[model samples]
Target chain A: MIKIAQLSCGTEYSSVQSEIEKAAFSVGGKMVYPDVGADDIDAAVKEFGFNPRSPQLKLMIARAVQLAKGVYDADAVFIATCFRCAEAALVRNELRRYIQEHTKLPVVTYSFTERMKSAQLLTRMEALVTIVSRKELLARERQTGLTAGLDSGSSTTKALVMKDNKIIGKAWMPSYDVVESATTVLNQALEQAGYKLKDLEAIGTTGYGRFTLGRHFDAKLVQEELTVNSKGAVWLADRQKGEATILDIGGMDNKAITVRDGVPDNFTMGGVCAGASGRFLEMTANRLKIDVTELGKLAEKGDWRNAKMNSYCSIFGIQDLVTSLGEGKAFEDVAAAACHSVAEQVYEQQLQEIDIRRPIIQVGGTSLISGLVKEVGSVLGEMPIVPPDSQYIGAVGGALLSSGFLM
Target chain B: MKKIFIDPPNSMILFDIVERLGHEPLSTMAALQERVDNLEIDMPPMNVTLDDVISGLKYAGIEVPSGIRGRLATWGPHIDEADAAIVMAEAPYSFGCVGCERSNEMVKYLLRRRGIPVLWVEYPGDKEAAMRMLEKTKEFLGGLE
Candidate 1:
């Protein structure tokens, strides 16, 4: 039986992986559905270089490196790309080139859109499986070991320690420097688990600062932000039998991920709009000269239904707040408006068209803010499942990847 | 010769029209490209750093950074240098690159604040509109020269 590795956005990975698995089984081939947690992040960054403008694109480059390393022992590789994702579209060709150059494995690419039918997906998967099976590839035994997953985000660094397929300890801290913060969080988790770094078999890193932390820690694996988030959401929600949409409002970006059977089925990310992110709330609170922690409480006291500040730009929105204040609008009202605006921005721009199933799982640090959560709930018409320790989902997923759970 | 700033800096038609009228065509894309080339640095389209956002807001005389400021900074230098301006109200929307609606509004706001002769043209949706646009654009460019 041929062993094939799959690479795709976390949102669509589960559904797409299932179809690929069905096809592979039919074609007498085995599928190696592992998260792209391979030790090639640094090499890929060196080869592709970095584009500071699109951090998402840089993550894709790192993913390509992971895939390159992943396919080293596999017979073939499959890359699934979301059709409307601009970042994915921009990086697809380069990712293919990198994988082809580094590995001799046959590579196949499929673009998935919301409009794509199941038959179309199955046909492509079947063809790829048929071709891969013809190569007579052999399956490798799964590796077993304790491992750690670290998430070094722009605002915070998180670390998770996993032993015997269970979370032993996890820690998170506000990030100042990538290396220092990541090490601090890792040490905390390690101390909780009563283990040293040498006790772990592998360390997988993810998130905005993943590349830097991966290098510093000599991590054995590095996964994309979306993939790690999806994995972590599934693990946290314990929704192994059902599908749920994961909404993550990070410091700089917002993501809406669709997960089915503990894997991402489809996902969409907010465009370059700070108003749709946590930064908007932070900036607005700063403009109001109020603490960010207090803004949520103030918003709870105001009438958000009547408070609508429709400015789509965060910079311009601050002016709106100032003008509202000058016009004798209550501070709580302005705070409420800011929260609603952020939620509305994300909903209208990113999640409006997505077919959101039941039980939306909200993750990321911003999810902890009551006002933002309430506003987002209003937009979705359903309360999102904001899991305890929601911000650590990505790191937990990274830990899961490190433990070779996805394999 | 007059220095006429053109919005939607990628519009070769407007650039040609301005140049044919014996005026210098100033555009944000040209200024930005010049800066990028001079530094021999690669800049992804629509990518803005916090510093770029701050500088753009500063250029626009706004004390805060924003998406508008970030975008305005790209063409603010050229806009500052121009003697007059021609704005395509619908051109940026057609190009599908001006993702920020506020930035689009800021361009017009900044141009008006410059206290220069500004020509506002709606991008043609039909042949009749196209003729009218060309005629109005020619009249505006001719007046500048």
Candidate 2:
């Protein structure tokens, strides 16, 4: 296993690092380094007169050199991480050096890019990694500290704890009272990680529920929703290949993220409407008497017919579903049709504005249904669909991010 | 001292301030053509771009009044050309209001990048804030002097 010797700056960083170390070591790894500070970054940047706006070519070259040096010195898996703000270019160069040092093992690095093109690249890499690194049995024992992530999404409050870049503990709950739900899931995740809340150094709050539940935690608030989701998607993908287009369907609205070149490039959102979202699926499921979880899988096996589901309105869609059912449509076919309808509508409105060249990653509670991905894939021909461990993507991403950040 | 251009017809205070500054109005025509002509001595032909809007006050083949063209031509170039800009904006109503707020930010970003000082007239419509706004504007202009 790749061991991460983690450190952060200030008391908060230390605390966060310690928590991660505890979680990481418990899962069979070694961690031996103090939390880092601005002084470390200062010393590194001063060597090259690193300007914040340095070109990507220069930054990548520098990161390769740094990653090599880091691996050689540490004798462990070295991953260099940075925030998306002014420090991104610098991190890029540093990551390269660390990677070179750990030639035997892969060195991971993440930069926050607001562009959809970059996000796609990162998504593919992480998804490939996840597929290869299946079945994380390290949770039975704890050796080094690990880090966990918390994603307070609009519809659900979820927490994921990780060690050695693998999932450890995960919990999800609908966001009713956001603070209470977040705390509950966070506590559950902490227990799973064999750590406590006091051990946490950094906590990231995201989604629309982020600002609303801001007062509850003493953690960092990632201002941009795109950054949070991009990081989350990358982590859940583990190390997958292919352009990642994350479709986050929530109760009140829906958000689409495109991760290209390991950074978020572009995003589009449906402005506050449950009609074109997971909530619509829920209502349809209730009326159809099929558990939402079984809907996708069942739809996958069933033969689908082209049933017209017009009227972008959810209320209208519900009436359409009812009338269509009254006309003797099969449950699996209708479910399949509804899935296709939503995907088609979304693509029509926003995806037309975007280049649908990459594979689409469907997330959120609605994504858990088995056949939805297949049906959506069939409707949007040639586009691959990557549906991860159900709807816990945000939570899993949160945990993986926490592991990286804390380390 | 460099000459600064003002836009639209006018207000009493804005006119008085410009007069008090002891600067000459470089005729609307000259101000509009200054940048391009300064590069080369060839003066582009003067044309009335806005005359077609004023119908009925025609002469022969010309459809609109050149006089009306002269009045509209007083403002040239976007606000981007200014070394500094002072926009009258109100709070709550105008703090994040679409056009005003966006324009204010864009102007500020442009001017600051150019190392120019900007004067902001917040709550311009409020009577109680008028004196305060004047004082701020004076101080800002004094810095330029």
Candidate 3:
């Protein structure tokens, strides 16, 4: 019997462990670390010569596992699914320590934020795949030859229609509604391909709005944004491998995934803050009464040698822009400089610590801006950046994943 | 003027009490640090510890050699200016939140240990109730006078 347990520490651990124990018992499995308590905490702290009140308590999870008696008939997996906070992280380490002190189990732990992203992706994929398979089972009976991918992003919605590994037709539109945005664009893409929705063999949905699309359509959704982008990017770049980092900058939010040896090991996202995203740039462009397209092109031609944006907050960054203008800096220079500043922040917070010794791929809506690519490249060094058809990697990946061409 | 200094990471109750005390209120260091990203500098953070709260009441200002009480205490002179000191309790019914409750208890304990007139202020959930409490406290202080 294989039993997996995700337990908490502090007072919350008792109830959670009880629930796990009951479930394991029903399944005819033995519990690991069955007698873990405050005594365990005291003995370990005493042996380790450390204060129990210190953050070291979090390391006890591993130690407790070491203290557990002999190997039982069941194989146990322990995952520390603690809440997100520095304190919680400290506590998580304590739990791991206890496990180490007691028994030896396959212990795996991830930060709360990373676990959340992984779970969110899993939730989306479950819904998307169910819908896609259902649509396909019906499509084979209907004798209709249509398949589509819908990307309902925060700023734009697009559909890619494909048949047998070839892009047959595509449709672009501004998206709305939880369901209709994905459905309408999908229908439009199928029509452009000269087929009906029922004609498509399978449809996959991907984007910031993928879950909403799942709610509306009977198609598969894949949430491995990194996997989706990597597949799409690898297809575009013809599977060349080295260290690779991909920056997918969308209108509202953006993510940077570091791909090593052709697989995504870790990634970082700027979801909680919009200031470090493409939307801030577009809004800034709008405020200046200039088309974002022109702003992008203008950025390619200017030099913001003196622009200084010291604020970590986007609101403050905007104020810094106004201050730059007041200092008699050219508007284009400030705008270009603003773009550079955001890229720098992304680099400092996300990329700087991670050694990306591979070719980097820049994708998504902001990838359309030649200046952004150029600026991001200047900071990232000379890495191979594969630009895909229509900078809509999310939707394209959804389509490709649905087709099973780039899973 | 009667002065009341409130420590940061305080008991929630004392936050309202010092505000009600009708004296100039200065928050302790940790409260200011928590708001560092959004901190506006109308005044720099005041450095004080449990012992300074008691000494401040006696000397009308903190004198450096007096030293701070409790763990992680630091010595600073300016803390003595306040006539009364308050510790803000973050927990409404209880004394403080998990990581913070320790410091809050320390300040309150040290002040009481030194026989300083330190008081625990409970948070009034509503604005009107808080104002009424303040008016009542002022009247009581006047009666004492």
Candidate 4:
């Protein structure tokens, strides 16, 4: 059995301790607490640079020191703490960084509450297992066989066909019912590529509708969007062999991920609300009486400073735009303001979660909007790479990873 | 007799019942009274000093938000001294909001982690639920030595 280190505080008292162990066990992992000598009690405080009243947290740091020193044998690490305790949160994040720097073991950090169940921890544990147990597959540089990938996103569905490391066919359309949307894009892409579903060696599904689509297609790989998107991003941006940060500003939310050598080490996703998303930009375009695509060109030409909008609420944001236009501001400037507002909100709310690396790759449908892309660059002070076919990222990511399952 | 820790420390139901059971109930109101009654400080507001808040670092980190630090400073040590605890979870906010969830979760975490006997019951929504809560409380307190 693969040994996965459980370095955490506060779970033993909470109802979720057994739940964590069960989740690990379900994924063929054994959760082991690294034992430390009683003598190391004070030494842990000195080494870890913090003293907590909880002996459990103190012992946790000592165990981390032991693991970093190679005194323990483990394939992966799961670092967790109670969501309520600020001290535990600090220790958990610091331990994650320390372990990642000291060892090559895959690490996943989580802050949980007393109400959390095992089901919530399962996918995280499964991802750690997948990263450790299938490193070779994830490390595979190029696709070698016929594989199909389906991405069922919030606002759109995408399907792609890949062969010999090259995308042969792809289709993007508005999302409808989960299975119907997936089937529609899958059929379109397959027909365009002149390949039948029977000809595919393996299939992978990802995005919001992954569970339903994976079941419908009997997919070989049903992976979360975090892993898939990172894989797809690095592959498309040619940053697979290096470290980079990924920014996918989606329709309903935003995701900021920091990756190392194409593997996602840290992932965070959320937005204040839909106000900081592409739907807001689309709404801005409608208010400006222009297509979403035209807003980009207009934004590039006009200055964002000329039109000011707050991304706190969509209604309030639109009102700002209307007021600006009533003040006789150009549509170009208003479009620029809309993109910049979304970018600023994303930078403020979402990007604060992860450490941004070089060559930040912006994917998802919004990445194609030149205005949003420029505004993101201005806000981040670093130009992001919008790789070719960026919109097909989820589909490509699913296809690329699932291709490994092909025999 | 055993000391019973009640959350919010202001719940009359918990305070009155635990007191009737012939045990000291560690309620915030009681603890605050003891602190404020001390004639050492000159301030009429009964406010704590900066030195007092930094002391909470033993319980939480310095990075913890200021408000939570203040709460933990006053309650953390008290929770440590608890032999047994009775927590009424999710008290309705409209009629009477018992305590902030963040405070409740933190206190419960500390109380439960000590391996102390804890009687966890939800705030009663009806007479039936109230009766059940009372029965559980009686059984739990009675079962304790």
Candidate 5:
């Protein structure tokens, strides 16, 4: 059997995995789905040495490392990309160059838009598999060892330890000081795994505070937070069967990532300088004297079809919300309107150009709020894939990077 | 004196008004003209570049060609220098070049993100709206002094 390892930017190709697998099987190629465990993410990062100032490019480097690992035993690799995504467009050449140089495996990249037909995709996959199967299978020679990945995000720090391609321990904490928070999580994971820091083969770091934490930990590699999130989303969703889009709504920023064949093809983000973000929701919830958790439930109960919040600016949105509430409008309706407003802003500002292919995988803390998910779903007209551990995806991807599951 | 960036930088009327008010009207065309004048090219080169193409996509969220970048580049220095902006929303649709819809949208978006005070007006269909817009533009620019 032709052993082909598949790697992608997780949520981008969530539902498309089955089609790829079918195409592989039809061509007498057995697909090797890498365990979503652990590998030396830091080592991978060091191998691809591009220090990008842009957060998106930085994350692409991190993801490139993981996807490169997926090429280890495969006859060929397929990278799903989105054409309109500025970050993906910027890093595409670099990623292809790294993979070709390091793995020497045949890599096939294609973009999937709503206009792309399944038959066309299957035909392309078949052709690639057929062409690559004639090549001799590469043997796997590396041994599994304990590795760790640390992700120090803007609001939290997460750590994961993997042994023999299996996740043994994971921990997270609210982040204040990057080093302290990272250390706390690392220690917690180490305790859970019953291993000393000295025993770990290598360490990788990612997230907003990656540079700081990498230095403090003397981390062997550093990855981008967005790439880690994409990797984690792919693993969590069990290799999405078709075109998948990852909508990660974080505390201050929102990201829309579309994956073609497990690689981020296109992506857009909001809230860099200003726009609606999770903090906006929190503030709005607080003003209504409701817990952030309750905003979703209230939205579900309210009939807010006509309630429109016109402003894309969070401050303006809040002002509108305040005025609406003061006008004796139903609190639930107003809450729903807030959710709708955010959804509209995301769609208009970020996703207006790209053709969003479903099933959309909703990740990040805000995704947990059912109201926001419902609002976003209504706007896209498709329910999103919300994993139980959505909030921990970034850290999980970081850990996975260390474990070799994601390279 | 305040520097005010005007959309449809080719609008001679808007440019004249800004000059009459004793403010510098920053226009994209002026920037291109300055570059052309400085270079003294035998033939006027296209104003666009790869940087503008990318910036149009990144900053303005519009897909445009290098040619459009040439025109957009003229507005950049003014955007940086301007104390305020006056946008005639329908100017591009009416009197200005309508070949690139994306470029038009991009210019508008860029102006909004400049974080400077901006006065947006419709292309006046009647004398009343035109007078109101003129008053608003003068008042807005006058305050910059």
Candidate 6:
């Protein structure tokens, strides 16, 4: 079994230690503390030229030092700290950077809460184990075999077929029925590719309905979006060998993931509300008496300051749009306000969870909305890369990873 | 009788409904009141001790403020005693912070970990959601014998 280094402060006091360990164990990973002596901690701290006030923080730094020096035995690192105090946060980030700089092992960091459960930590654990155990698969530069992937999203179902590193066929539609959507999208993709379902050598699935669809199709792989999306985004954008950040705003939540050389080491998903998601934009379009497709172009022509959409909750956001329109505001300006509201909330709430890196790749269906894309750009002060066929990210991600099974 | 734990312990509305349904309602107000009424070793405003606060470490981390820990200390045992739980999340429970929001999370987490029948609902912002919560709570409590 792969051993993942567990280095964190206050997990024991907070009583979330079992949850973390359980997550690792469930993913076929054994969580172990880097065995370091008291003398080793002091010497490493001195050499590292920093001292932490908390003894827990000091011990955490020492373990990181030992792992970085190759004196400790581990496959991957999981660094976590309770959501409190500036010093612990600094130590968490510093050690993560130090360890990554000194070693090739994948690392993931989390700011845990007292209410944290094993379910919340399982994906991160699974991703770390996937990275450590399947390093060669993630390192593959291209897809060689015929494979199919399905992304059973909350709002839509998407399917794609890839052959020899090329996406030959793809289809997507509203997810009215999970099973029906998956079957229809897959069949559509197969027909477009001029191939039968049995022609595909491997099948993979991802997204909210992944498990349900995976069971239906007898899929070769059922994976989470964190690992699969990063792999696919880098593959499509041709940034497979560099650092990048990925942003995907879905129907119910948003995701911000940071990648290094096509491997996801850090990612944050979900927000407090749906205001930072694609569903909010659809509501805005409905209120404006326009098609969702037309809202983007109309928004690009107006200024958001005129509408004053300051609400970060979905229900209140709809109220704001109605009040603005009720007072004789133009549709174009209101459209811009709606787009800007979603973008700003994504920036303020979700983006705060991860350190932003350049070449930001925005995926999912929301990426096609030029106004949403432009508003997000203005919020971040940099234009994002919306790769070709950005809407099929999950399907493409699933197809790409299933290629591993083919190998 | 089954003991049903209701979150937002200050919600007398929920408390009355739980009692009307013929089950013991385990809430923070009831627990704190029991301790406050006992004159053997406590005063009015301050009923719990340092040991109580430290015992909260069993459920929460030390980084959690002492105020939240003390509140959990009052509710923790009752959470363990519960036959079922009904949580009203993201609801406007009180005008003051009461640290209830955070402690409520810790309480709910404990309830989940205990592996009991849990009915989670959002605080109703409208008549429809309120009716839904009431109906769900009735079914949940009625089935808990």
Name the top lDDT candidate: 6
> Each candidate's TM vs. the true structure?
0.51, 0.47, 0.55, 0.69, 0.51, 0.70
User: Global lDDT for candidate 2?
Assistant: 0.49
Worst 10-residue lDDT window for candidate 6 chain A reads A9-18
Query: Any residue pairs clashing in model 6, and if so which?
Result: A14-B61
lDDT of 2 by residue, A270-369 (tens): 5334557777777778888977767777666556564556658788888888887888887777777777667666666545433454667767776676
**Each candidate's chain B TM-score?**
0.78, 0.42, 0.44, 0.88, 0.79, 0.86
Q: How much DockQ does model 6 earn? A: 0.02
**Interface root mean square deviation of every model, in Å?**
15.7, 27.9, 17.0, 16.0, 18.3, 13.2
Q: A270-369 in candidate 3: lDDT tens per residue? A: 5556677887788668766787777777777767577666566778888888888789887778777867876776776556424465667777777777
Model 4 misplacement above 4 A: A1-41, A50-60, A78-92, A110-125, A310-330, B1-145
Model 6, TM vs. native: 0.70
Interface RMSD of 2: 27.9
**Which pairs of residues collide in model 4?**
none
Off by over 4 Å in 5: A1-144, A164-168, A240-242, A272-274, A306-308, A405-407, B1-145
- lDDT string for model 4 (A57-172, tens) is 67778888888889988888888776556676667777777887788887777766544566666656766777777778778768769998999888899999999999999998
Instruction: Give per-residue CA lDDT, model 5, range A1-407, as digits (tens).
Output: 76665543311111234445666676566656444222343344466765433332344455556556653355655555343444444355556557665664555554433223344445335434534542221111121478788877665677888777566888887789888888888999999999999988877787778778878877765655555576667666755345688898877677776665445544555453244677788888899998888998998777566465778777788888888887888988888888887777788766753447787889887887888899898888887889867776776665555544333
Q: Sum up the clashes in candidate 6.
A: 1
> In order, what DockQ does each candidate have?
0.03, 0.02, 0.02, 0.03, 0.02, 0.02
Q: For residues B11-89, write the lDDT of model 3, one tens digit per residue.
A: 4444555455555554433333443434442211232222323433342222211111211132112133445554433
Candidate 1: residue B1 Cα off by (Å): 32
- Using DockQ as the measure, the top candidate is 4
Q: Which ten residues in a row have the lowest lDDT in candidate 3 chain B?
A: B63-72
Candidate 1 overall Cα lDDT vs. reference? 0.68
What is the per-residue lDDT of model 1 for residues A205-255, given as tens digits with 9 covering 90 to 100?
Answer: 887787787888888766557656777776777765577889999887777
| TM-score, first chain, each model | 0.64, 0.60, 0.68, 0.84, 0.61, 0.89
